[model samples]
Target: MSLLPLSLACWNYDRTEALANGSVRPEGIDLNFQALEVEETFFRMLRHHEFDAAELSMSSYCVTLARDNPPFVAIPVFPSRLFRHSCIFVSAQSGIERPEDLVGKRIGVPEYQMTAPVWIRGILQDEYGVDPASVTYFTGGEEQPGREEKLKLDLPEKFRLEPISPDKTLSRMLADGEIDALHTARTPSTFYSEPDAVRRLFPDFVPVEKDYYTRTGIFPIMHVVALRREVYEANRWIARSLFKAFCEAQRRLYDELLITASLKTMLPWQIAAVEETVALLGEDWWPYGFSRNRAAIDTFLRYHHEQGLSSRRLQPEELFAEETFESFLI
Candidate 1:
């Protein structure tokens, strides 16, 4: 069988392991898969025409692409409900006993524009009446925020923002008390952390409720796999096949016995985290297909716009390929 030319890019998370291992049938040329440190950098590679396909954070990718209107188009693999358990975790030692205690605190986030923490912080500030400026938001490393000027997102005042050179080391610092909190948008904590080393302050932070998850759908907080418009138009069959393969992979992975076994073999706490995520997401949060929920996607767009993260008001439909999505659904 002739292999298709597909280059898959993803964030540095463990869930992608299933995708990397051909959990679904491998399609496209394995130009070799690359996992990136942040969604912003991953999108940079996409814009530079480095790869054929990639999984990106839907909200972050949409906003970034909408800035100059990149030639690529996103096809969401799963609804946002699948991302419910992704959270803002605080260290138990930090004495951040409650979300209300986060005021004027130094928060350590994985990336400059990760979606979960942005919303969590906004909820704290806007809904809880905390001062945004008092909160110190630090990007892990030295890489500066690229979309800041283009998107015009307002960062917190006097923030200790710096991108981490090695993202793994940033996680270490978080464990060692170098940072107060880590913003996570993945179900499994092992992708960027060790739950054993750090006690979770928000063990019950289920940002998306079940009804909202099933209805308006969960926003893509973590990864969104996208294809360039021209490429997608030419190789529509490949797109369809890849989506099927990915969904199949997710389905197999989410199988309770298999998932529990996989976790059991890894670590006790890892298993716990997976179970926690499963409990939070219920049974529906598995990758199925690239069906973009316009309303939920718009929530992200409006949020980024309100945060001054993006200058342009991105319409969700512009970022996704509706025709292809419809084909998948049908």
Candidate 2:
């Protein structure tokens, strides 16, 4: 039988390296895995549908689902997961010492609908009682010029979001106190270049993020692997095949990380770090599949709806292909 040719665009994550290097091939699929930067992959896939499959922003994917016919369908394979407490930056002049201080302040974000900001805003509201509607949001490029939301949003009147000037970037704006704070996925250049001007909201974020996980059990998901709807419609079996392959790849990564004889990564204490994470989050800390992530997915969906990103609340099951929800018993 001929293998179905499929092109996937994603970052070079250690977990997915097996797929990219051709060490693990998806069943009945000719995988053309393109290791591209996350931003580039998202731009090309969301704007032009350039690949058969791609790693997509979870928030953006949810935004697409609000449409009459979403262009893509997702498998449960998450390529990126992050704890975003460290992503929040505040201006020295902003007088924002705590999360509650962000109320009635101006926050710059690369995009209002980006996953990191969505999670940050939601976290602020749920954990800190800082209502998202109380603060105004300025959207623009982070370090470059002329950046805009990849998809059009029809956010309600309660959410005050405006675009910064085409030439202005969020990093500079935050340092100059043009915006009181910044919520972003990437650390801005100004954070290092203008240390006195820009500082992390949680200067010691490691403990804060770990505490958040202890309370909420949500190690936030940033990205998911998605297939073009046309491709999924014609070849439904690829969802399961690709999901199994990603699982296999992740298992290999775990094995590599456990090899204490020689460190699989550059970190001299890589095993110690892994041990610490397992102690905190259990053996399968970074889990895939619908059932394992239902709480986190449900929380994010609620945030999506509350923040006016999704027109209606979406269920956890609605986000993934049905085939990925379960596996056949051996």
Candidate 3:
């Protein structure tokens, strides 16, 4: 059997470090792993098809599904999962005390169609009775200035979004009181330099996020591994082979978390945290595959469609390659 040489672009995460470093490579693949920030990977992959396979934003991926000809198909491998509650930051002096208080305020985002902002906006509207149209949006860079959306979206007429000048960053705007709040994946520098300038919308997001998980069981998936559709069609077996490699890599990470006696982690209670998380989410907490994560994926598609990002609600089956849908009993 001939092996394929392929490019895989993704972020640098401990769980995926094995794949990047070739410690656990996909069978039959010679992978050129390009580790980069999420925004950069998503932009390059979605725009230029820069890699044969890449970790891509879920929201932008959904949008692509609605387009006439989607360029890629995804595997259920989610490299990043986060609860967006902590992503919301507000000016300390803004007087916006709760989620409901965002109704008439100005919020800044790196991109409206970005996965993190989609989750943030969807959660606010669903849990807090705040329509996206009720608030104004400012789109720009979070720390450095002049960022633009990777793709275009036809946001509703009532939903106001202003493109900030290339010179003005969201962090600076929030600190200067130009914007009332900031909704971004990046932690803006203003919060670090001037701690008093801003505070998290959920001051202690852990409890709120825990309650949210109890209610919805959504850990909030950020990125999915996508393969160029042409490449997938040409070499269908690679999908399952790749999925298996990712699963093994993830299992190695989870197994290491159980190494408490020797202290695999620097934190004194790192093992305890891992044990507690398993008790809460389940043994295979950070799972891949459709069956394990159907509810979260379904809910995300619903929000994406409702928010006018996707032309239609794309099902999990529709977006992922068929080879990745099943696994053998080994």
Point to the candidate with the largest lDDT. 2
lDDT of 3 by residue, 168-253 (tens): 99998898888999988878888888889888899889989989999998989998999999999899888888888989889888
The alpha-carbon deviation from the true structure for residue 245 of candidate 3, after best TM-score superposition, in angstroms, is: 0.6
Candidate 2 residue-wise lDDT at 14: 96
Of candidate 3, the 10-residue stretch with the lowest lDDT total is: 321-330
Over 167-273, each residue of candidate 2 has an lDDT whose tens digit, in order, gives 88999999999999999999999999999999999999999999999998998999999999999999998999999999999999988999988888999889999
Model 2, position 48, has a per-residue lDDT of 97
Give the better candidate number (1 or 3) by TM-score.
3
Q: Which wins on lDDT, candidate 1 or candidate 2?
A: 2
Local error of candidate 3 at residue 32 (angstroms): 1.9
Across 1-330, the per-residue lDDT of candidate 1 in tens digits comes to: 677667766664444456666554655534356666655555465447567777655555655574454667776564233333336666545677766787767676655566665565554564457554566665543122222211224453444465444443444555666666666554324324566656555564454344345554454454567776677788676666666666655666556434554562456676566666577655654544434355556676776666556667777666666644765457
RMSD of 2: 1.0
After best superposition, candidate 1 residue 322: deviation in angstroms?
Answer: 2.1
Task: At residue 295, give the lDDT of candidate 1.
Answer: 57
